[model samples]
Target chain A: MLKNLLLNRNLTCLFFILIISSFEKIHAQNAQVINFNSLQKIYSNKSDTTYFIHFFASWCLPCLNELPDFVSFSDQHKNEKVKMIFVSLDMKKDSIKTLPQLIEKFKINVPVFLLDETNADKWINMVDKKWSGSIPATLILNNEKKYKKFFSESMSLQTLNKLVK
Target chain B: MIKNIFDFSLLVAICVLSLGFSIKGNKSSYDFHLKNVGGNFVSLKDYPSAKGFIIVFTCNHCPFAKLYPERLNGLNSKYKNLGVPLIAICSSDTITYAEDSFLKMIEKAKNENFNFPYLCDGEQLAAKNFGAQKTPHAFILWKEKNNWTIKYSGAIDDNGAEPDKVQHHYVSDAVDELLKSKKVSIPETKSIGCQIHFRK
Candidate 1:
């Protein structure tokens, strides 16, 4: 009886560990890191892929609230040659703590990036003149050749679908 | 001589009428006010000693605003003494996000040691008047003769994320030009920051 109880406890521990490990693995598969240089290269090389760049900050409640829609949209359209990039506008200091947690919590299925540029104005203009440095802003590009549209509001999947299509 | 005088008066009347029309059109920028962090009311008229007022629509929760807290503080400190008083307004809806409430605003101001008066636009009337769509939106008001005019409106600097990378300091440069009795070259630029949270 004693031996059986000990064996049962050991099995339960193993089961919990396996569940946690699988969860971690699944999360790791969902999020990929992309830097500015990598992004430029991807856009230049894969001209067929539609790029959706999202400007967000961890501190922004609207951005946080809208993240799930973005993740679901990315998952639903994985085979459509569409790519989603989450560009966090979080300060450089908060990147390590906030960025990964946000990516995990939102179950983001896309490349995540931190805007490492120092000057806010220069980078903002570089992205688009109409951006106005607003969080939860999205820039949709068609095949890296066309400037599709820019939205300075929380996005819905319907809107994303329309833009991509 | 009487006919010449009458003609000159007619020309002056036409010019005056056109100027009045333009000022009325531009009244939107001047028609707003915000409650200061101290819960005291303040408006463009409150700064009687100022040649102009720098109205910055900013918030505590925006990373962009957090990044430039010191730069803004410095601008306020330097310019306030020189006759251009800075007024920082928070138009974000604090009812939903409790972190942006008036209390948090006080904490942010105290923690940042802000030299300027941080104001709260509780009803967002001021934001609506200016059509402010984003946090960190700026409007530089200049007093011309007795009327207040908008000299510059938009981003504070060319650098959004990195202060060190700034190519142009729009607010400071405009104030400097105004001090020199010259016109601001760039009157407007695109503003970037968190979207102003309007209450439903």
Candidate 2:
């Protein structure tokens, strides 16, 4: 009886370790880096997934304030066909320190990218002529249908849901 | 009694009208005194050699402002020599974003190789004075016989993205017109940039 009990405990420990290892692997896969060029391809591939691109800066208060809402929205609809991407508008220098913390803190499961280009005006205009170079901006794209909308303010979960639909 | 009531009502009406006028007159101009990146008090009157002044509502973190740092530096280099000193005031609230702090402003200026004065608007008084709504808002003033008159108020340029695509260089054009003793051709334009983050 003593031998059987010890064997049971060992098996339980082995099970827990396996579960933990699987979790770590999943997290590592989730944290994979998605660069901008790949994102462009994703948007152009006519995939069924809806892309939600958020333009944010480390120093933008409004962007930080609205981040939690986006996280919750992403979580609630994780099973859906929606994919989220955070694009950091922080200067290339600050991105090295700030972007990773933001992704980790928010537990952002989707891809996150940093805008590496200089001369914001040129790139901003190229991204969307109506952008007006504002932070806390969002671009919702239905890549399958090639439909897009630009939101210049904070978003609510209800609004995000509606956009996804 | 009826005559007296009429006189009282007329007096109240005149008082209201005069108050409106006073408010309108007060909207003409106001003073802003704020600390610079070095923690020294900087005011409009500090530039004794300036005929007038240029106040630009800018911040260290806005990508829009970052894009035009060199342009603004060049503006300061040229305009200061021509008697118009430039002052960049950061009106973004620093309470939430520590990066916009006065110390960070100094670091940003040094990193960007700034040549002009960058002032910290602790309470956004300068932004309120000019009704600046966004980062990179420009207000140019000209002294007309010792009275500082606002010559131009608007965006720095029509094209903020590519320097080459700009159809109109509003600030430079206004300054040139001021130097030529002529009124600004375009007195105002819509400002496009990051919204000024005001503290709640």
TM-score of chain A of each: 0.73, 0.73
How much is A5 displaced in model 1, in angstroms? 28
Instruction: Specify the highest-DockQ model's number.
Output: 1
The Cα RMSD of model 2 versus the native structure comes to 8.8
Q: What is the TM-score of each candidate against the true structure?
A: 0.76, 0.63
Worst 10 residues of 2 chain A by lDDT: A27-36
The candidates' DockQ values read 0.46, 0.15
lDDT of 1: 0.78
What tens-digit string does per-residue lDDT give for candidate 2 at A1-165? 999999999999999999998865554444334545565676666788788888877767688888988989888888988888777766555565667677778778766677654445345654566665667888888876878898978787788878876
Model 1 residue A30 CA deviation (Å) reads 8.9
lDDT (10s digit) by residue, model 1, range B10-111: 999999999999977865546456667777777777777788888898888776777778888888889988999888888888886577899899999899
List ranges where model 1 is wrong by over 4 Å: A1-41, A44-46, A144-147, B1-29, B158-167, B189-192
lDDT of 2 by residue, B1-200 (tens): 99999999999999999999997886665556788777688876677678777778898767677778888998999899899888888988888557778899999989988888888888876787787777888889887776677878768987665778777888988998888888889887654467877666
lDDT of 1 by residue, A1-165 (tens): 999999999999999999998876655444445555565565555377788888887887888888888888989888888888788766667676666677777767577777665555545666667776667888777755655677888888788877776
